[model samples]
Every structure is written in C-alpha cells, then in structure tokens.
Target: MEFADRVILVTGASSGLGRHAARALALAGATVVLLGRHEKRLDGVYDDILAAGGAQPVIMPFDLAEADDPRFNALAATLAHQLGRLDGILHSAAQFIKLSKLEHQRLKHWEAAFATNLMAPFALTRACLPLLEGAEDAAVLFSAEEHGLNPGPYWGGFGLSQAALIALAELFAAEHQDNPNLRFNVLIPGPVSSPMRHRTHPGEVPENLPKPESLLPFYLTWLGPQSRGRSGEVIRPDLGYDPSRQD
Candidate 1:
C-alpha cells in the first residue's frame, strides 16, 4: 500500500467526490478521517471501506459552515493525539444551494458558501499546519470547479467562493514553496456524474457524464507520493485524460 503509513483527512467524505476518494485512499492504505455533516452517511462510507478490507476510517460528523478557530484547533489537537501525524488533506467539502440569479440569492447563501467552500479549508488547514509540516511529506488538495475559473451568471456565490478557494490554494503553495515537506493544489472535477451535478443540471442525462470514480486516479496522484514538489496548480482532469475510456 502506497499510503500504508499515511493519515489523510477527507472533508465531505459522506458523499460525492469526497466519499469516493476517501474509499480509494483507504483501500490504498491511508488511515482516512471521514468528515461530513451526517454521522449516518459517514458511517456508510466507513463501513464500505472496512468491508472492502481498506484501512479503518474515522468518522467525524462536523458542520463545515459552523467551524471556527477553536473547533479547528481542537480538531488538530485530537488528530495529533490519536493519529499523531497528518500526511494529506482532501478538501472536497462544498456548499452549493442552487443556481440562481445574483439578485435572487440570499445573504445566508453567500455566508454558507464562503464558510464551507473557502473559510473551512483556510481555518482547518491553518490549524493542522503544524501536523502537516511535521510529516516527512504532505499534500493538501482543494476541490475546485471549472466555472470558478471562468464565471458566468446564475452560478452566484458558489462560483465566487470556488474561485477564491483556488486563490487560497495558490497562496498556501506560494507561502510554502520553500518547504520541502508540504504541497498544495486545486482539482476541478468537470462534468462528473455526482449528486451536485444532478441537482444543478437535472435535465442532463447522468449517463452522459463521466462517473465520479473516473476522477480517483487524478486525486490519488496528487495525494500520493507521485506529486511531490508540485503545488499551486489548478488541475482539470478532463483536459488531458480521455473520457471515452470510461465508456
């Protein structure tokens, strides 16, 4: 197992990209900490991993939108006490209410979007910086969106928050460019068949979209030892990877 000795924290592990990636990482031998809002859903993922003979996973039912400095610090401390090291983080948690016109979006929507999509990663990563730095090698992967890079109407705060998430990742990389132990990067999973995609584009056929499992190779590449020293780049797997193979 490539990650047999690694401890990786995966946000949004209850569903979507986070769920799939956590499963794969665990199977690859990483001790996965599954963080999500729903304990039952997290348990589902936890069970799935263990049933497949993957490494045992920790279920953390946490609300990203409500995370603060104290909570984040406590989380870090707990990880340190229990796992003792953090080798990687997959920031796949996101908050997407619905696609609406700028005027139609509410203040709460903006708040929730920024909190879950941008601020949570910032706070969590900041709190865990020490643990990550202490490791011989560490990587932080942020889940981004293609629309975040090229924004359009109706995407609203969700889009804006994703754009800012990219900037956050870049800034993390720039700040740690000289640190040989750490790397930060963003991944944009484009047109994948996910619950979020189905919610946003109900009219589109799910069968036409590439399955979420197809993006696992890209995620694993960044989280595993292969992408050492690579940081600050926004990766769109659809660009270089062939989607037809998934068919």
Candidate 2:
C-alpha cells in the first residue's frame, strides 16, 4: 500500500485518529497535508513525522467550523498552486460537544457540529474535486459513527451530522460513479480509544479498546491504490464487515 508520490490531506491531524492516520500515511510515502485548528499540536505531529523519517508534512491550521465557502475555495487554490494535484482526502475532523436530547441542545452547538462534521467535508470535497480529478486515481474518505448508523436517544447533533455525512458520501459517490478517476467512501472506526470516544464513553476502560493506530490497515486499503474501483461503500472495520453485504 505504498503512496510514493501521492499527496493526501487529513483534517483533525493534530490528534486522535487524524494524527495517527497522518503519521501512517507519511510513513507509507505520501506527502500529508495536516489540517487542524491548533498550531502547537499540528507542529507536534509534523515534528513526529520528521523524526520518523517520513516525508516532511505541510501544516495548514484552519478552523473548519468557521470556514466559509470562500475560505474553502482559497484553500483549494493554495493546494493547487503548491501541490498541483491531490491524491486523496481523509475527512477525520469532527465535533462531539456532548450527548444531549434534541430539545435541550443549544442551537449554536448544533450548528457547530453540522458545520464541522458535515458542511465542512461537503465544501472541502467540493473544492478539492478538481485537484482530485487531476490525479490518476483519487479517493475521498468520510469518517462515520456507529450512532449515526443506528441512532438512539441523546445522540442529537453529532449523530445527526454523522448521519448526514453518510448520505453526503453516497450522494457524492453516485454523482461521480461514472468518473473513473475519483471515488468516495465512508469509514466507521468503531470503539477506537480516541479522545472523542473517551469523551463520549468516559466510563469505558481505555485499555480495553483499540487505539487509533488500529485503523491504519483499513485506512491504507481505502486511501491507497487497493481501493481504486470502490465507491459509496460504508466500511466498518471493527465488525470485520464486507462491503458486499448491504445489510
């Protein structure tokens, strides 16, 4: 699963699954563009990649929640001027403020969640499509959540955003199904011991759960050449599920 000359963008690259994915992708020979709001944390990941002999990564500190279409377009322009083309994008940034009932949820929190988890990906992908289309084979991966798939009480904004992301991925895939160069897929990294998971399930023993690194193989499979023809599939690695099975 080598990405010798590939250029990939990973949001939320300062920590958790995004950080781990950036490191692994760098190790796999891809020039990873790390995007996050925290400059200090982004530098930490960048230095770690350098220390590990991985390709020197680029850091783009930006807040997804506040990013408007113009900002997204500017980012796309910058990437185009610098990298010329993009091989893939892993939409790993997310916002999970708390678990609350819809009635009690603050409108600001709801808007923020959708902005980061859904709208940002949609706009970012839309902006990057031209760059992706220029690549020989390109992929866009949307992070999914189990609660989004099977919603229950108290899931509220975060859950709704994720569910919308699933639909968004499907819609993008269907729209581009005839385009041999581009593909989109959703990945649900279930029960990973991420900061988001820790906040969501505080009582769970962290040691019992898989770390973010546990999803690397699946990441490579989806983002690299191996997943070229696949599109619009929900990939749930934790369940050992096959994409062929609709249910």
> What TM-score fits each model?
0.96, 0.95
By how many angstroms RMSD does model 2 differ from the true structure? 4.4
> Model 2 reaches what TM-score against the true structure?
0.95
**lDDT by candidate, in order shown:** 0.91, 0.91
TM-score of candidate 1 relative to the true fold: 0.96
- Write model 1 residue lDDT over 45-134, tens digit each, in one string: 999999999999998888989978999999999999998999999999998969989989999999999999999999999999999999
Question: Candidate 1: where is the Cα deviation over 4 Å?
Answer: 239-247
- Note the residue pairs that clash in candidate 1: none
